[model samples]
Target: MSGSNKTDFTNPSTFILLGIPGLEASHVWISIPFCTMYAIAVLGNFTILFIVKMEPSLHGPMYYFLCMLAISDLVMSMSIVPKMLSIFWFNSREIDFNACLTQMYFIHCASAMDSGIFVAMALDRYVAICDPLRHSTILTNPVVAKIGLAVLLRSGLIALPLPFLVRQWPYCRTNIIRQPYCAHMAVVKLACADTSVSSYYGLFVLFCVMGLDVIFIIVSYIQILRDIFSLPTKDARLKTFGTCGSHLCAILAFYIPGLFSSLIYRFGQNIALHFHILIGTICLLLPTMLNPIIYGVRTKQIRDRVLRLFTHKGT
Candidate 1:
């Protein structure tokens, strides 16, 4: 091709995110529920952080891990929701090329970090239940801080190449992304050039992070269940099981939909594209919406703190 033709193939300065294909009529209605979910998620997570910070009794490994989880959810939710709401409510779908890449970086990195935080939470539970005596020594404050830093850095390193890889491609074809949020694969597909590098890196880090972390979490739970059942008394077993209610609820709410959505997106290409968009949106929002509620209701400490907050406010 000649230089003039090559020049004509230059990328668009901005990407127009077509929030949901074939569903523009319902976007105003859609924004109502989305706005509600986003507000709930952000407020709930911040509430958890506030309670954790204010309560001196919450300064343990379990709550430390909870703190990390709350922060991860906050980052993930904020990374996607504002732009998503903007698209839905105002049709402000046009995002600068660099801003879209920035969104992609934060969204994926925050998601990967959420997986690591869950792993950390699982380990915290395992230590608390299986080796109660060693929990403090093993998961000291300094050690927890290190684990948090490591989780963030791990995802940061893996997601570092995604923006550059996607950006280098020319968007000579479609400049519209299919989703409300700027997802890596969605953005990459809009590029006219080869997207193999970005695709492979995304898949590689996804499996590496999700694969190892989920396996370890399962193993930790197995050990936990075994330890619980081995206790001499039924009362002890019931008590131990009760302790896991919140975390288990969180795990199920998060991983099941998240994993299923991912699988369907990769393998169920024959399925309608709208289903993919809907499932992806649900998977991202549902866990975040439910997590704080689960912890607030199921964990006695958090529940008590919340009640006390209400009572004191009333007084």
Candidate 2:
């Protein structure tokens, strides 16, 4: 029986994607919410970019970082959702080997970039609240440009090696990935050769990027809190803290689900596969959908501008 069931493919031209293994019967129903979220994410992020671009008054360091966050959310969602919908709605599952790797690279790169942007936003808030006298000088146009460039380069370069690393290993086990989209470990687990290096490198990247960013963000906010309380008046303290409310919400929306999904994928062995896939999908899509909503509702300037635009159109 073992001999008869031997693996034949060394490196297939295409791989199959199984969208939510045990939930095959619910694929159509599942696609409904995913599609809804994807649409909202696209529209919301684009609106953010458009508003920030057109309103010169909003073109500050904080909004500049928000633009970066919006762009990353777009890239991250577009990299996965369309193909995932194809699988669920149309039953189209075949993905080219190179395409799979490319998808994996963009998904991870965008995620890393989002985390970096959050950190940038945190620092922007820190400077604005803690050292208001120099906020403008500290985060000038040139400095903001440099920071954005660093984020792009860092995320791209770190994720660039992942595909090449996975490609070096021959995949003889199977060509069917059990997730809606191509994920790093999902692909790595398919290789017939030892994947210890790939696994270790992935963990290292996670620690270096997400871990350090989390620590820095926490530290920045702690200092920000101290400075907020130091304000002489209660109204001043409330106003200062209110400025940070949207950023705090966006940070939580992005990190909590993301970290939970990552941890579950790595250690939750007893968890059902479909549940894992669902959480992972939510981890990616939820934040993309929520970031714009959080800012639109929480940030006074953005909220006013958005409402004005709609009201002007109505008139």
Candidate 3:
């Protein structure tokens, strides 16, 4: 079956996607849950953005980071879901080379931005904890905007070379990507060339984007723990740590699955390739969709605003 669908070396223009295997025959039915999640993801993140915008009290660094995260989540959902839905709903799993490259680039950019927002949240925590006196000064509106721009440029620069590198592949054997979306490693693995370069690039970018962020966040939290432990008053210690509880939870939800997914994809022995598609979908989609809801429930300000908005509407 694989040999029949495989591309001939002489004619390689478009890629055929197996698209979740046995489910392709039943894509329409399978797509229902995916569609529902995608819808909820959009609505949930946008609602968080709206809440942050409407509440003047949330116009600070932490909320600024939250809003940025919401925007990133929105972009992340939009990048992959529509195509994923189309693939399942309409049975069109074919993505052209240019389109595939474009998809991979934008998706990576969104992923990087999402990860960067976590770093920004860490910085906010550091300022609020380590240098309370200058928190506002350190995270001014202008500085926040500058930081956002820097994140954009940095993520773009990191993901920019990936497409060109993949384009150089001659595609001697097959163009059939087994998954619905264009994943970097999945695509690179299909290349007939020596993939050591692409693999190195992928790992390097992953370290810079996710690895370094996780390390810094851990270090920051350790310092935060030290400061909290040193506080004289019980109430002071509780209050200081209270603000970080939501962020800590958010960081865990975002990074745990991410790190596991990367490690499994890169180094795990005898792992099925299809598991990559499944795990990647879960890691990328779940956090983007759930982050806002998690924060809204965990953070008092957001909860209060949500309650007030609903109360005002009822009145």
Clashes per model (N, Cα, C within 3 A): 0, 0, 0
Give each model's whole-structure lDDT. Answer: 0.85, 0.92, 0.82
Q: Note each model's CA RMSD in angstroms.
A: 2.9, 2.1, 2.4
Candidate 1 segments exceeding 4 Å error: 1-7
| lDDT by residue (tens digit), candidate 3, 179-232 | 888888778878777878888898898876678878888888889899898999
The deviation in Å at residue 112 for candidate 2 is 0.4
Tens-digit per-residue lDDT, 145-208, candidate 2: 9999999999999899899998888877788899999999999988888899999999998897
Q: Which stretches of candidate 3 lie over 4 Å from their true place?
A: 1-12, 267-273
Better of 2 and 3 by lDDT: 2
The best candidate by lDDT is 2
Give the local distance difference test score of model 2. Answer: 0.92
**TM-scores, in order shown?**
0.94, 0.97, 0.92
Q: What would the C-alpha RMSD of candidate 2 be, to one decimal place? A: 2.1
Q: Which of the numbered candidates is closest to the native, going by highest TM-score?
A: 2
Model 1 lDDT per residue over 17-74, tens place: 8888888889888778778888988999999999999999998877877887888888
Q: Which pairs clash inside model 3?
A: none
lDDT of 3: 0.82
